[model samples]
Target chain A: MGLSHQSIINMQPDVQLVAVCDSTRFVLDMLEKYTGVRVYNNLSKMLQSEDLDAVIIATPSKFHGPMVRECLEHNLHVFCEKPYCLDVTEGERLAELAKQKGLVNQVGYHYRFVGAFQEVKRLLDIGAIGDVAHIKAEAYGPVVLRPSGSSWRNQRSEGGGCLYDYAAHPLNLVNWYFGMPESVGGTVMNKIFSADSEDEIYATLRFGSGLSGQLSVNWSDESYRRMTTKISISGTRGRIYADRQECQVYLRDGGNLPDGYLSGWNVRYTTELTPEVWAYVRGEEYSAQLDYFVQRIKAKEMDNINSFTSALQTDRLMRMLIDDSEREPIAASGDYQPLAKGNSSWWQRLTNAS
Target chain B: MDKVLFGDNQFFGVNHMSEEKARAQSMRFRDTQAMIDVLDMAYEAGIKTFMCTTHERIGEVCDYFRKHADRYPDYRFYPGMPYAHKYANAVTDHGIVGAIKRFLPNDGLMDAVVRGGSAVAKKEIDGIATLLIDAEMKMFEGLSTPVIFLQNVVTDFLLGLGMKDAFRVFADHVKTRYNAEPGFFSMNMPRLLDVLEEVGVENPIICSNINKIGFRMCGGVDLYQQILAQRQFRPVAMSVLASGAIPPREAIEYVCQLPKIESIVFGASSRGNIRQTKALIDEFMAVRQD
Candidate 1:
C-alpha cells in the first residue's frame, strides 16, 4: 500500500513527495538511492526535520493511533491507512483531537471511492432500494492459505487478522451505509489457518432503524485471485447487489426510481460510473481518495468522506464484534436424559409392547 | 495476432462467474500435464497464439513448449508483464528493494541495478519500467512472444495517473529492445485509445472487455462501439462471454460483427469448449469477411 501511494504521489502534479520514512533499512536505502528523496528510520526525527503540511501513515493497524496522534500533534493533516485504530476509545479520542484541531484528517477506506459502491450509496440515499431491511456484507480472499510464520497481518495484536485486514472493507462500507449497529449477536471468529488470529468471521448486526445485516468474511478462500468484497441489500421494494466491478439493483413497481434504473433490474458497471482520476495506481479509488485528501486540505475543508470520525464508527463496530464473540454461550446447566426415567408414559408403554 | 487466441485464466483459478467452478478448474489443472493437455487441445484446434500472464507456473509451460518445439512449431506467446501477485508476495517476503532485486534478470545484476538506481536518481521512470519489463520477460526467453502486453492493472493505473509518457516508454522499450509490438490490456478501451494516440502509438493493439451486455466495458457499450468504428487501432476483444452471462454464440457474434475487432481471446478448460468457441469464432469471422 505504501508503494502504491508512492507511485500515485509521484504522478500527482500538486503533490511533492519530499521525504519517506520506513523501518526497513533496505527499503529506505533503495528509495533514497533511486528517488533521491530523504529517508528516515525514526518518525519523530523525520517529522522534526521536514517542514511538511501533512503525513500519510501506511503502517500496521496497531501503530495507527500513536502515529496519527503524533502527526496531529505536529499540526499536520493526516491520511492514515484503514482499520483506523485497534482500540475504539483511542480512535474516538484521536478523532476528537483532530476535530478540535481542525485538521484535514482522512482514513484509508479506499472502497468508499469505488464507483459501483458509490452508486449503491447513491441509490440507497435516494431510497432506490426502498427502506433496506436486510444486508449481507462479505469479503473473501486467498491471503493466508497456510500459516508459514508470524507476520503483522496474521497476528491478533498487529493487524487483527481477517477481522481487520479483510472484513474491515465490507464492514466499513456497511458502516458507511448504515452508521452503526444498535447491537450485535451470534458473532463468531474462527481460526482456520492462522494460529494466533481468526481467518474467518461471522456476525449479525441490527441497526437503530431496525435494519439487519450479516457480516461474512474469510481470508483463506483460495478460489479468489484477490480480495473480493461484496454487499447485497434486500429492501421492501427492491434489492441491490454490489461489488468493485458493478452494481445490480432490482426494484419492484411501487417505489420511486432513479433516472436510469427500471422496475425490474438495472446494472451499472464501474467503468461508466467511475470518474477519471488524474493519477491511478492499484485502483481509481486509491488515487481518488488521495486526491480528495489533498484537495480538502488545500481548501481547508475538515469534513470529508472517510474522515477519522467515520472510521471510528467502523472501529467501534469491530470492537462490538470482538466483544460479542468473546461472550460465553448460553448453555443449560443440567443435562437431560432422553426419557427422564418416569416422564414418558406413552414411550414407556410402546417400549414395553416392543 | 490471430482471430482466435487462447487465455490462461482458467488454468489459474479465475472464474469470475462462480467460485465453485474456479475451484474445480484450479484442482483439475494442479498437474502441469493437465494444463498442457488443454493447451495441446487448443493447438490442435488451430489456435496458435497463447496470450498469457507471466505467472511463475508459466515458466514450466514455457519449458514444456521449449522441449516439444518440433511438436508445435507455430506456437506463439503474447506474454503480459509483472504478474502482480508475484511482486506483491515478494514485497511481503522481502522488502521493496529486495523484491526488485529478486526479480531482476539473474544475468545482468549489476547493470540492471545501476540502470534502475540511475533511473530513480534522475527521476526517469522509463529505465525502471524497462528493467522490470526485462525481468518479467526473462521467463519468456527463447520463446516466440510477438506481442507483449501491459496488464490492465498497471495500464489503467498509468492511464488514471495521466502518465502518457510512460506508455510511450513501454512501447518504445518493447519495440526497440524486444522487437515486439506493445499491446495494452485495459478495462476502458476508449480512454486507453485516447492516451495511446496522444503517445503516438499508431494503430496499436489494445485488448479489453467487449461483451454484448456491456459487461466490464468501462465507457459503456455504445462508446466502445463508436471508438471501434472511428479509432484507428487494433481492438482485441476479451471477456466477450461476460463470465458466462451471455450465450457463447451470441457473445462471439456480437464482438465479431463489431468494426475493427482484430482478435478475440477466450479460455476454456475442456477440449469440447475450446473446439466449440474456436469453431464459433471462425464461423463468425468467415461470415463477417464475406
Candidate 2:
C-alpha cells in the first residue's frame, strides 16, 4: 500500500495524494513524512475530514466489502485489492453501486496489466489462437510450508485459502477473457500445509461451448521463487504458455504475426514493454495498474476491463467453483468398478444421464 | 508398493486439465504395445512396482506381465479399484446387467450375484460392496497386487455419505478374499483416516495427493505432516509434482526429505521423463538413506 502511494506520487502528478490513513499511527506518520500529506488513523475520519477524490482499499480481504461500500457511498472512485470481497453478494452489490454512481472502480488484479498478458489479450482478440478450446491456469509458489501456517491466511473466513487469495490472480485473468464458465468441478487439497484452508486446488471448468479449463494453484511447495502464475491457452490453431515476465506462442498457423515468423514457437518477453520505473516495490505492474486506475478516473471511464463487474464475475466464479467442487468433483481417472454400478433400468439410467 | 511406483496416468488419458493433452495421450497410447514399451523402460530403469488403476486397458498390461513373469520376477502391481470412468463407460456401452456380468469373476457367478442381491435385499451394504471388489480384482487375479487401494471417487463419496463402516467391509474382504492388505486413496485423507479409525483400521496404508504443495492432500498439509509425525497411517504420496507445477529435483528432494512417506507414485510417457524422475528420486532417496 505504501509502495502504491509512492507510485501515485511518483508517476501521476495529476492525481495528488491528499492524505493517507492507517490503523497504526506509526504507519500514518511515516506516510505523512514521506508524502508530506495529512494523515489519519481512521478511514472514516479521513473520509469525513478530507475532500478526497478517491480511496484505495488495500486492507485485508475481510475489510474490502465494507470499505468499498463506504467509498462508493461517498462517490469516490475506488481501487480495491483482489478477493474483491470476502462474500460474492457483497461484491455484486459494490459493483452495482459503483455502476450506479459512475465511479471508476477497479480490482487490483495486476496480472491483467502485465505486458505479456496484455499481448496475449491482443493475440487472442485477433483470433491468433483461433477458437479457444481449453485454458490451464496455474499459479504455484512457496507461500506457506509449515504445518501450522501463518495466522489469518489459514483461516478460511479471513484469507479464503489458496482458492480465494492465490488463485484470484489467474482466475481474474481467465475471467477477463472467458467470462464465467458453464460449469465447474474439482477439489481443493490441503496436502501438506496445516492450514484450515487448502494449499492446493485442482479444478476443472467446462464452458457451455465445450471449452474445457483447469485451474491448479499450490502455495505449499518450496519449489517456486514465489508465486509465479502461468496460464496455458490451447486453441484450434496453436498454444500459448505465458507467465508474468514472458509469453511463448506456438503458432500452428502463423496468421497473426508478420511474414517469416513462421508456423513455430516464438517467444515474447514482457520486459521490453514494461516501462522503466524508479518507485513501487513490486515491479512495473503495480505502477501500471495504479496509473491505469487513475487514468480511468480522470477519463470518467466507468467500464474498464478490470472494472467492478469483472472482479465481481471472478468472485462469483470462485463461489461457483467452491460449490461445484463439493457436489461434483472431477476426480483423477483410474479403473475400478463402482460398487453401486448397482441397479438402474437402462431407460431410467439413460434418461437420468442425459 | 515400491519406494517409487510407476503409475498408469499416461496410458489412461487423464491429463489433469487439458482435453487436448489427454486426447493426444489417448492417441499415443492407443496401441497396447505403446504402454508395454513404457513399462519395459521402467523395468529396465529398476522400477519394479507398477502402481496402477484397474482401467480395462490394464488387462492387457496384466497379460504382458503374465507373459514376462519369468523375466521380471520382482515386478508387481499395486492396484486401485473402482476407476469410476471404467464403470461409467461400461454402463454406457453394456448397461448395468451386462456390465456386472462382464465384471463378475469367472470362479463365482451365481454366488457373487446372490451376495450382491442379498446385500441389496438385506440392506447389508457389505455384500454388494465385496461382490464389486471381487469383480474389480478379477483382472489382476494371478498378478501380484500387494496393496489394493480403494479409489478416491468412491472413498470420498462414501466418506461424504457417512458410510464409514463400508470401508471396514472393503478392508475385511480385501484381506480375506484376495489375501491382500487393503489400502485407500482419498481426496480427503485425514477425514478418511478418522473414518478408518472409527471402523477399526489401525495404522492403515493410504495413497493420496501429497507434495511440497498440498496439491490434493485432504485436510491441510500441516495436518498431514503432523499425522505423519505422529505415526498414524502409512502415506504414499501421489501428485508429488503437484501435476507438474514443481521442478523435478526440488519436488523429489522436498518430499523425500519428509518423514514417513512410504512411497512416491508418478507417471511418465517418455523414457526421458521416466529416467529423469527416477534419477531425481534415487538421488534424494540415497541422500535420505545416508
Candidate 3:
C-alpha cells in the first residue's frame, strides 16, 4: 500500500487530497507531507465533515475491528492494514455485517500482489512445480514494543503481542497458500526479548496435502535483521527453490552439468526486486485495493478480503503456534511399565518419543 | 568347623550404598557425613560391617571404600548385589544404567536369577551360579576375609515369571553348582525352610530378618514346634516395634523374648534411627544380668 499510495498520487486525476488519520501525530504529519493531505487527530470528526469515499485504518491491533465496523456503518468502503483484528470472531462478525450491508473491505497483506510471488503461483498452476506441495514465508520486526517501552502490545488484554502482531503475517500467507494446517506442534521459548509476547517461536505446520514445514520467529536472536524463510517442495517430476530473497529452480538434466559446477552449469533465475521494492511496485501491478472497493460498491457485491472465515482460520493457526510452544518438556521414567499392548520391539518404544 | 555353616554369620553394618537416599540427598550424598556418623555409632555399639544396599555410581563408592580401606581394616564391607531394573526407577546424577554396571562386581546369585517376566530357565540358573562365582572370586581373591553373597529374599517378587517352586529349583541348581565351596546366602528369616533342607544345602546361611506383623515362618503350631526341635534356629529380629508393644528404646529386650533369636537387625532408615537403635541395644546390655 505504501508504494501504491505513491502511484495513486502520481496518477493525479483531479483527486483533491482529503484528511488522514493516524494514531501517532508524527506519522500523520509525515503522511501529510508525502501526500499533501490535511491530518485529523480523530477519524469520526473528519468523517462527519468531509465527503469521503473510503477510510483506511492503519492503527494498532485493538482498534482494527472497531474502526472497520464504524467505517462500514457509515457507508464508507474500508481498507484495513494486515491482521485486521486480534479476535477473529470480531473480524468475522464485521465481515458478515459488511456482506449483509453490501460494503467493500480490503485487508492489507500486500505480498499476495507481489509479482515474484504471483510468478511462483503461476508456475504451480502450470505444473512447473509438479503437485502443490506447500508454501512457507516469514517476516519479522523489532521487539514488539513502542519507543516509549510501554503500550497495549505488552498487555494480554490488548491482543497486540507478537503472536498476533508479527507471526500473524506469515500465518496469513500460509493460510493463503496451503489451506489450513492439519495439526501444528512445536516449541515457543521466551528466550531473550522477554515481554508479554513470545520472544522465540519454533513451529511445525502439517497440511492436509501431507507436506509439512517448520518456521522459527524470534526477536531475541543475535542479528538485528536476519529474516530466513524458504519454500522447499517435492513431487514426481522436479523441485523449486523459493529462497528468502531470490527465486531459483533446479532441474534433473541428462549428464548436462558437472558434479561441482554451480555457476554456469546450474540454471539460475533472478528477480529485479532484490535491491528495492519499487521494481515490484511499478512493473508488477496489484488490484488498486481502494479501486477494487469502489468496484465492489458499484457491483453490489461484498468484498471478502478480510472475511470472517479467513481471519478465524488464521487466528486458529496463531493459537496453535502459541499452544504448542507453551507445553512442558518430558523427563525420563524410573521404571518401565509394560507397553500398552505387548509391543516388544524397539520401534514400538521409539514412538514414545513423540 | 560346622561344615557348610547355614549362613554367612555376617552382620549388616554401615556402607554408604543406599543410592535412593543418596539421590533424595543428591551431590549431598555423603555431605551430612551420614555414613561416617552411622559407622561410628554402629562401631561403638559393637556392630562390625555395615553393608550398603544401593550405590550412586558403584565405581565411585568402590573408590571411596578403597581409599578408606585402612580405616575398616578389621571389618568386612559386603556390597549388595546390583541388578538392573528393566524399567529404570530413578537415575542418579552420574547416569542411570552406568550406575548399575558399576556394581556388577558386587552382584550375587539372586540378582542374576531375577528377570522381570521370563521364567527361570536352566540357562538362567547356570547364569546366576556363574555370576555368583565370578563376584565371589573378585571379592575374596586378594582379601583374606571371606566375601559372603548378600541376597535380599524380597527380590523373588520382582521375578514374577518364576513361581516360588521355580526359584526353589533354581536355588537347588545353584547349590549343586557351588557344592564344594558353597557361597553364603542371606534370607529374610521366613521363607519355607523345608526348601533349604530339601536341597541338602549347608552353605553358611543367615536369616537376616524375623517375621513381621504376626505371620509364623511355618504355618501350624505343630510344624513350628517340630521344626524348632529338629534343627537350631537363628533370628535377626526385624519390625519388633510394629505392634507398638515394644518401645524404640528396648530393642534388646524385644529380641530376647522371640524364640531362637540370635541377633537383632534394627531398623535404621536414617542416621537418627540407627543412633536410637544402637543406644537402645547398649542400654539393654548394661542392664543384662549375664
Stretches of model 2 off by over 4 angstroms after superposition:
A1-11, A33-35, A253-260, A275-280, A328-354, B1-290
Give fnat (model 2).
0.00
For residues A1-354, could you state the per-residue lDDT of candidate 2 as single tens digits?
Answer: 443444334334466667767675544543454335677778888888889888887766788898899888988999888878878787788888898889998888989878788877878887787889999989987766666524555666785577877888898888877878888775555556654777788888888777888898898765553467888999988888888766778888545653334578987655344453322233457766887888888899887868888888888888887776667444456963434544766876898799
Inter-residue clash pairs, candidate 1: A34-B120, A279-B161, A280-B161
Candidate 3, residues B1-290, lDDT tens digits: the string is 11111111111221122212223544333343544554555655456654433233333434545567787675544433432221122222123233333333433446543531121222233343344334433432333223333344222221211123333444454445433222222221323344344445433344333333222222332343354445543334433443233356553564444455444554343456556666665566455453
Error of 1 at A54 (Å): 2.4
**lDDT score for residue B217 of model 3:** 25
Compared to the true structure, candidate 2 yields what TM-score? 0.51
Report the number of the highest-lDDT candidate.
1
- Candidate 1 vs candidate 3: the DockQ winner is 1
Answer with 2 or 3, whichever has the higher DockQ.
2
Model 3 CAPRI quality: incorrect
Collision count for each candidate, in order = 3, 13, 16
Question: Each candidate's chain A: what TM-score?
Answer: 0.93, 0.87, 0.73
Q: Go through the candidates in order and give each one's C-alpha lDDT.
A: 0.85, 0.75, 0.47
TM-score for candidate 3:
0.44
